[model samples]
Target: MSDTPRATRPGKTPKHGTGGRGAAPERDHLRADCANCFALCCAALPFAASADFPVTKPAGTACGNLREDFRCGIHTRLRADGWRGCTVFDCFGAGQQVSQVTFGGVDWRAAPESRQRMFDVFPVMRTLHELLWYLTEALAQPAARSVHPAVRRTLARTEELTRADAATLEAADPGALRAATGELLLQVSELVRAAQVPGRRKNHRGADLMGAKLAGTDLRGANLRGAYLIAADLQRADLRFADLIGADLRDADLRGADLTGALFLTQAQVNAAKGDKTTRIPAGLTRPAHW
Candidate 1:
């Protein structure tokens, strides 16, 4: 009924859409490729003139490592060259989603005037894509089956946010977005923990549970904003730093756990508690400053 033509003189499990077997999904059209993108992430994001790189760059300026073809010239040795940030950043299909889905593959180079629009929307698109990644991950939880409907609804909402106008997207505050994602993630956490470790009650907010055994936990800065927590055990956690705007205390257990500079956790979140002193605060927040 889809106007799809019949193949093989009958029905032998009709071929995949016009593209071929698993073509559209396999294509992952939502993913970006430098071969097609303008390297917007590199061009739109700014980095300090730190030891990570030889120079500092402003937003919209191309990194020194970027070539005319929009590929990183030092792709193979970014870490050695202090561009390690580039190596770890994943746009989560934002680049391709914006390029193909939003703009229909209209390259900035091909349409110079489109550059302004592209730059303006790049940041918002990245945020939406990042949230999309987390939402997709949240939906994968078997224990969170109880809230699958909510997850689906939120996922749809976030997806719509991605397609919003620049004004609307920009108007979306980080705090609000964090709250939305946090609500879903918290549900996911409780579901998984309840299903796996029944009768286990872990006090998260304002409680110093450092060096605690928190294996297979998912605590990506679930608020805890301004809570007191020093040296809590957090291992095998899937932390994406989405809700780390203003967490508290420090010296928490983070061995084998992936903190990776979770969002908004200040030096206070580290210095006040009991971490290895090596507890990773977000790159934007550091010790001594909070001290």
Candidate 2:
């Protein structure tokens, strides 16, 4: 029998509290449990040789660097070996959830028939987990207190869907689910951003601000949802209480920027950008090593 690879967890600690809601959500479910995973990411997904991966790979094919035990042989040296894309990918605990819970601990190698189904469920689980992350963040915002009850209800609904079987998962439409949750999150973000001092909030929601020079910009309580900020110069920018739900921060410079209270800022976005010691992120997100 082939050995299973153990998951490598991040060095950071998760945030505590009921995510600020009446019920304490399962925070552990959001973090990747690589040890229990079947290396689905390295096998099920496709990648191309670019500034990220070192080679091109087709879907359902395993990476050359994947060890026999389902571990990445170059895990610690992914960036050094021209695999930056692999380093930025965060399943948000979807890997383990699908491997262990959805598939009932049956690995693709052990049960070849389940391989295709495993690949199908992985992305769906990722989307559901992402929604959970945003919902948890919305519930924790004190300024969004008016929307907490609704957020909790949505969170429960979303969690229920994540536990579906393989066939149900394959038939699931994550786009519709994401759209529904996004509507509520937007409402919560609006309430929180509006509570800030008048005239200080900037509204660039869904704007294409790609590569704009926003260094040292005063963006307190700005609504930058879905903004394409790829490679923007944001050094020393003030982004406290900004709603960054779907902002593309790929290669953005965040050196010396203060994002202490930024909302819906995921670790994947931060990992794709540049930052330094002075780039203050939210408590849950860890600093990227490349910065």
Candidate 3:
């Protein structure tokens, strides 16, 4: 996956309402459940031939390696065959949501008329699910208690959007919603970082630190949000409590790096980076197999 920055400037907070019936689903619901999905990621997303992919594939077209049963033909050998991007790409459960929940288990093959619409809605749902993941994490931070109420409300609102019908989802504009959530997350980051780092903390938000040698550095509570750290040497770096949201860590050396309590770090980001068993990651994320 490319290390494109996803951060946006803070915007006005949006209004929230009481969420839909029943409590919000657990974190597991926000993760990609391929068993319950129709392989939307394989068909809906387009890719160009590069270091990450061996061949070019267009959007709304099933990958050449996709099997009739919706599984990758070479799942076990994706990376070895030069499909490294597929291993790190994540849909955050949006595939199953669009396939089973929104479309009621209807596969695009069964109803070709809905193919284009389904492909379009997939990305929108993915964005909403990604926001939900961050919002859920924000609510778990005790130091951000002051904003927990807002976080809960926003989570509910975003969840409600996920349940909307196909047409509604296709036309949904999550740009404003993303900005609002970004602002709230910034507040939470400040609260947690202030409490974790006693004195002056490094502020490197949006810095271009690509290929920089930062081994064994003290970066506790640092705001490295949206920084480009591609191919940088971060071995044994002290990144505890660092705000890593939107940081591009592709090919960055993470051996022995302490990412415990790192804020907004996603599995895709970790999977894209180089790490080892000694790298300490936050709870709930699996260590990359290549590490």
Candidate 2 weakest lDDT stretch, 10 residues: 8-17
Sorting all predicted structures by TM-score, with the top scorer first, yields: 2, 3, 1
Model 1 sits at a Cα RMSD from the real structure of 12.2
List the candidates' TM-scores in order.
0.60, 0.91, 0.91
Provide the global lDDT of candidate 2 against the true structure. 0.82
- Model 2 ranges off by over 4 Å: 1-26
Q: What is candidate 2's CA lDDT for residue 245?
A: 87
**Model 1 Cα lDDT, one tens digit per residue, 111-212:** 787777777777778766656555555555566777867776777687777766656755777567767777776776566555544563434555444455
A best-first ranking of the candidates according to their lDDT comes to: 3, 2, 1
TM-score (C-alpha) between model 1 and the true structure: 0.60
Candidate 1 Cα lDDT to native: 0.54
RMSD in Å for all candidates? 12.2, 4.2, 7.2
lDDT of 2 by residue, 1-291 (tens): 012245533232233234443654656678776777788888888989888777899998988887767787877777787888877788888888888878877788878999999998998989999999999888777888888889888988788778878898889899999999999999988888877635657889988888999999999889999999998999999999898988999889999999978989998889889999889999889788888
* Candidate 2 residue pairs in clash (backbone atoms < 3 Å): 7-34, 7-35
Cα lDDT for residue 106, candidate 2: 71
